[model samples]
Target: MGAMAAAYGPLLPYLMRRFAIGVSVAGLVFGVHFAGGLLGVTASMLSLGRLTSRVAVSGALGLMAIGCIGVALALSWLVMLAGVFLIGIGFGALDLRINQMLAYSVNPKRVALLNGLNGVFGIGAVAAPILVSIAGARYGLIYAGGAAVAAVALLGFRGVPGRLRGASSSGTAPSSRRTARLVVIFATAFGLYVGVEIGVAGWMPTHLHSAGFGLAAAATLTSGFWLALAAGRFLVAPLTLRVSDSAIVLGGTAVAVLCLAGALIAPFAPVAYIATGLAIAPVFPTGVAWLATLNPANPGATSWLFPASMVGGALIPSAIGLVIARVGAGWVPTILAAVAIGTLAAFAAAARS
Candidate 1:
């Protein structure tokens, strides 16, 4: 899922060339993809009451496999969009279900485990560009490969159980109020954090290219950002033995804000962006774990977070694009810094209350 999701950006130029389309038409890929993701998340949330984990997870994987096949066979750009939309649905549902399952699990090592799981996603994300480079104009092979993996992964879910131990629970009014507040704060925090993460990733290459770096160099630095994220997710799991999840999120976001601030300097921009990814790597998984702990009575507490993240992924970067059009690409780091600051503030508020 992560590989296919991340593949889109690196694969965009090929997509455009393959269909003989301009940037204006090609850009709709993101919108179509994310729109499918939002609907997928909603569908997953709605299915909480009716669907088993095995059924939901399996079905999502099936959709992803079919979507990839669709993209692999598509001859037109619109068909490719449709394929990506299908992939987004599967991606969104599988993402939510897996995290939800892990967060609500009873394992003592679950925090580290969750971080590790998300780190694997980072690994997939980091691998995507390389895969794109290898596949070149035949990028459909990458999607076809992803489809094979997704299909094979279905066998792993046979023992996931129809329901989890803590999958469902009831809450009282006071706890409900607290849960609602935490949800809003964390959801907002996640939205902003995802926005910043995706924003930096989506714009940094362009920003660096505009600043005079060669296209290849800019792309390499962008890959560094993803590598840092993957590395951080793996490395931070050890810290969970000594530190609390909330503290980790707070510290990570704070450092990310500082890193983005440093990125405003042209020479330091690449290092700063990479550092920002490293700092924020553990925030998403750690925050989800922390929220589950806080609202143990409601297993569905983390469901809303998925939608918030999707919205942020779509909205924040688009907002940054508007500012970039008016001003320039140089403001990319500045805008990301502002978003990181907002993320830090949101996490801080959540931590306090």
Candidate 2:
């Protein structure tokens, strides 16, 4: 999932060259891909009772492999989009099911495990840009490799059980009105966070290139950004033992805002963006654990978060693209800083709710 998603960072230039498209058209890649993600999450939610994890996870992997092949062989821009949408579907469904299963598990170490899981995602994300750089115009090779990886991952799921038992909790369900409020607030927060994350990952390379950095250096810096994110997740797992999840999230977001602000300087851009990754690493998983703690009765509390994230992933990056079209890519970090502020506000609202 990380490799497939992060490939867009370095792949954007090749895509524009191949399709003879501008930033605006290139922006649709993230939109169409994440639109499919929303559908996948919705489908998985709807199929909870009907489909088993073994079936759902396996089917998703199958779709991912098929989608990657579709992308690799696409002859036209539209066909490539169709392929990306398919990949999004598989990515969304797989992401939701895994997170849902972990959220409902009885394991006491689930929060740390969630961080570890996403850390692995960071690993793949860290590798993708380097691979894309090496592949160059043969960008299709990256997608083909993603397909191969998905195919191999299928074998590992054979032992996964069909049904997951929801962990037992003693908290009473909140009033409907309060519950709805919490949902809206957290949804907004998740949406904003995801938007910021994807927006940075998708646009930072281009931003750096526009700022006069070489493409290869930009790609390496992008990988470094993901490396920081991956490392932060592993480093923060132990902190969960002593720090409150809410505090961790608040502190992380605050620091991320500062890092993004610092990124506005050309000389500090790479370092600042990489620092931003570390700052925001704990927000998503820790937010999940925090939400679960707040609303224990609903094992599906985190379900809303998945679709919200997909919405963020879809809308924010495209929105950034639009901004780039109008102003220029150098403003990328400024735009992201503004989005991070919105994210901070949303999380604050969630805290009150």
Candidate 3:
């Protein structure tokens, strides 16, 4: 989400002006980033045997940092698009490697909390807009762009030692085919969850504004959604210890579905927005925790699943953009409702499997 905020936050309006693109086109640009993520996931998988987890992750972060620099320096639309793709590749690799490390290295008792901490990404997402807005307003876009590049570079270096330890574990490997299949399924579920989460957060401002919300109100509503999502993950940590993962997921999905529907029917913008946030809160980290359980021996499998989910994360929002273009932005919440329901179904299927 940090990557997302850094990639799209201030850049959205700027890209719109520079490229003469509409919301849908902007969504497509985001989609380009996801497409690169898809490539990165595939690349990581292919190089699984050749590269240590640390090397892969560091390479990914370098790619992301380079992409950020590219975005900062981009003079044309094509250059911007290329930068976005590189960012995707970097993001995918980083996500995959980190998840792999977490799944393998963390004690089972603490895994859920660690997963919840991943909500830091949402914090980053939340901060990006404000930071970029402030920086762009004060120092101009160049400064804002440089900040993002520096952030990626710094984080990438900091994360290297952990990734190496994760990949170097001496556990027996799971069957490659089985791990791959599980990763695919896990990715699908996560992808759908991310798609819905991002879709709602990305479009909420417009959705609320159209419903008569003022700009401040709309921004607050959007922030509420992410805050709730971040908080929910933290809250669920202890709860997961007392109850089964499947039950928690099942209950969360049900609440999410009901809340999403409530958002669709809500007459007041604040009610709808708050409901939407509450609905999406538990879906993401819970999904990650579930995937982390799939392979005790091969934590690197989580790397594959993480990136896959991110690809979904990137794609579904793009799909929502297309839907908005074809239908209208006002319909975004309803579309998000559908995604919530679909994720519930995916979780159910995975549980059954």
Candidate 4:
């Protein structure tokens, strides 16, 4: 999340200023980023049979670090676009491999908790804007903020374990066709959910600012969305133990729709902005937990779902960006609301399956 949010958050505003682009173009940038991830996912799946899990993960992280540096240093919009694509590819590979590790490495009872811990990305998402806003305020766009994030990611790469490397050499025997179909279903649901969540979170600060809030105020609102998302994921483990996963998912989706609707239609900025966070809280971790339950044998299923969702995360915002350019920024939330409805549909399908 830090890598993604760090690369994109300031990068969004920077791209807009540099290219004289609109929100749609900004969304397209994200789309291209996810397109990179799609490529990464395809690559990882194909290579899983050939490479050890550790090598795949390490390679992915290495690519991400390189991509981060590229984003930080790029001189032109086209270069930045290419850099973001590399970032996507790296993130997708790391995401898939790490998830594969988690699914295979731990006990079934702990999978949900492990998944919730992944919600730390939301924490990073909450921080990305503040970091960019503060840095951009002082050092100018190109020199300070994103560069610092890249440096940190490079340093952090050292902490990744050696055991996770080359673990996939164990190889795959034939699995049930039903299992593959289930993975596809879950992946599609995840794709839609991610698209809506990231699209809204990615674009919300700008949307709120345009709606008449100050940058500080808008950042606070964006933080609320991520904080709530993180908090929701932390809560999901206990909640799942009590209620059915389907009930929680369906109820969360219902609340999300209402929150998004309130954000879209409400006349008052404070009410609408707060509604955005309140509505989005349950999505990421809850979605992962749902998938984990469906296939206890493979934790990678959750990882696969995450990237698939990220594909949506990349695409939906681009779609919203297109809408913003043509229709107006006010229409972005309406687009978000529609995506929320689609997420609800995805959840329903998941529940049925």
Candidate 5:
């Protein structure tokens, strides 16, 4: 779902051209998806009481498969936006459920386990560009393939016994002023995280292309960005056991800020993008770990996190689009730098939690 959420980036240039839209409208494409995603996440929170995790996961996957095919064959702006919206819902629900499974594990699913799951997500993100680069001209193939995978996964999910399947918490919920504060802090940080992370993934191809790189070159740079993201997850997973998770997050965001600074200067180069991804990788898992560790009774609390991140996904990219529309692509770094600062703010607030 993370991969599908971000897979639209390299295709943005094409989607803009194919649909008769501008940069600002291009960003709105993601906004609608996040809107639906927010709804879906909210629904999952409610549905937890009524459904098995396997049923919820399966339903989400089916929705995603249909949504992908819808986007792949869309003929109008309304249709495309609808497809994106459905995709958002499915992605949001499935991921929220997955996080519930991981975060609330008896083993607690921390350190290496958490990193492995996260690294696979990064790899999925990496695969998006490669799929796009291979058949970008006929981009529906990517969506079609995604739909197929979702279908297969949907089938595989049925094998799980109801016993091992995911379950919703029926315990008395934790609703305190401090809990609210922690939720706000974590949600804020996650929003910024998605803003920069998905924002960069969504726009990097166009960013490079605007800076005079060819289509293929831009796609490769985009792939490199995701590759670095995967690398960071795999490499940092082990180190989390040694260094404190909070330190990793703080240092990670700080380095990410510097990398964005580098990107501001070398706007066209892939190296800066790669470094930015590498620096950005550890923040999410560690933040979630920290959040879940502190608030176990509300382990499902982060059921809203993916949706919150999707909000960031929508607004941040849209803000960048506004900049690209009103000012110029050169000014994009300013927005990115501001986002990095926002990320730092999240880290500071998260530490307090």
Candidate 6:
């Protein structure tokens, strides 16, 4: 879903021309996508008692497959908006549900495993845009390919319900005031983490173009970001076993801040963007791990992160666009630097709270 929705970043300019939409409208489109996601995750959590995990996962994946094909083939602006919104719902639901499941099963060693799984998203982020680039047509066969993959995945959906059932028996979430306070604090951190991550991915191409880079070069840099992100998740996994989650998150965010500083100040932007990806890779997965520690058993404990993240993804990039319009895209790095710092500070506050 990250890839499917984010592929639009590099393609946004072309999409703007094809769909005859302005940057503000385009930003609104992106916002709508996240809003759909917020709805999907919320509905999933609220209806958990009525809907089996198997049915929910299957339906969500199916929607994703359909949505991707729809977006790729959409002929009008409204159709594209619908497709994007559908993709958002699918992405949001699966992301929240799957991660919630992982949180339910958390242990020291398992935290590393969770990071590794998230790394896989980086791989998809890299590939999805490239597939669009490779197809080269306004509407291409690659979108349908996503649907086919989802169809095949449905065969394996049967086991999810069993796992969810097992999760219910193994742990107990906190009900105290401490848990409520921690949840509120961590939700803020999670939102910022998601905002920075999605904002960078969604707007990098546009920012690079403003800095005078060509389309191909910009797309390559964007892919490099995801590549580094995917690589970092695995490379850092071994360290998670030894390092405290707080230290790892702090270290990662601090290095990410430095990378954003480089991106802001450097003559060339790709190097900094790539380094930023690698440095910031640990934040989300480590956050998931940390959040589980606060309230290990309740999936809803972690559900709040999804809504927070969705709101962040929706608002921050749009805010960046509005700022870029006033200040120029050269300020992209500076803007991102502040966001990176904010994330670092948010995590520190969460640690204390």
Candidate closest to the true structure, highest lDDT: 2
Candidate 6: deviation at residue 208, Å?
1.2
- TM-score for candidate 2, please give it: 0.96
- What is the Cα-based TM-score of model 3? 0.83
Of 3 and 6, the candidate ahead on TM-score is 6
Clashing pairs in 5: none
List per-candidate RMSD values in Å: 2.4, 2.6, 3.6, 3.5, 2.2, 2.5
lDDT of each: 0.82, 0.87, 0.66, 0.65, 0.78, 0.77
Candidates 2 and 4, the one with greater TM-score: 2
Error of 2 at 314 (Å): 0.5
Q: Arrange candidates, best TM-score first.
A: 2, 5, 6, 1, 4, 3
- Tens-place lDDT digits, model 3, residues 1-353: 36354336234555677678787787766678778887887677566656776677778867776776777677778888887788888777666655555555557655576546666766665655455445442323543454476565656564455333334434324458877776666667777887776677677766776677654456555666666666666767777778777777777877877777776653764566566565566566666666667666565566556565667767888888778888886787788888878888888877887
Clash number for candidate 2: 0
Provide the TM-score for each candidate, comma-separated.
0.92, 0.96, 0.83, 0.84, 0.93, 0.93
lDDT of 6: 0.77
Greater lDDT among 4 and 5 belongs to 5
What is the per-residue lDDT of model 5 for residues 43-105, given as tens digits with 9 covering 90 to 100? 776776577778889989999999999988988878988888899889888777766677667
- By lDDT, the better pick of 1 and 2 is 2
Score residue 22 of candidate 6 by CA lDDT. 71
What local lDDT does model 2 show for residue 151? 98
Error of 2 at 51 (Å): 1.6
lDDT at position 67, candidate 1: 92
Off by over 4 Å in 1: 19-25, 168-175
Model 1, 1-353: lDDT tens digits are 66775666556567768999754455566656667788888788777657888999999999999999999999987788889889989988888888988888888778899899998898887777677766779988888998999989999989877765555423212247778888889999999998888788777766887788765566667777888888898899999989999889999999999999898899999899899989999999999999988876466778888888878877777666667767888998989999999999999999899
Model 5 regions more than 4 Å off:
160-174
**Cα shift from native, residue 147, model 6 (Å):** 2.0
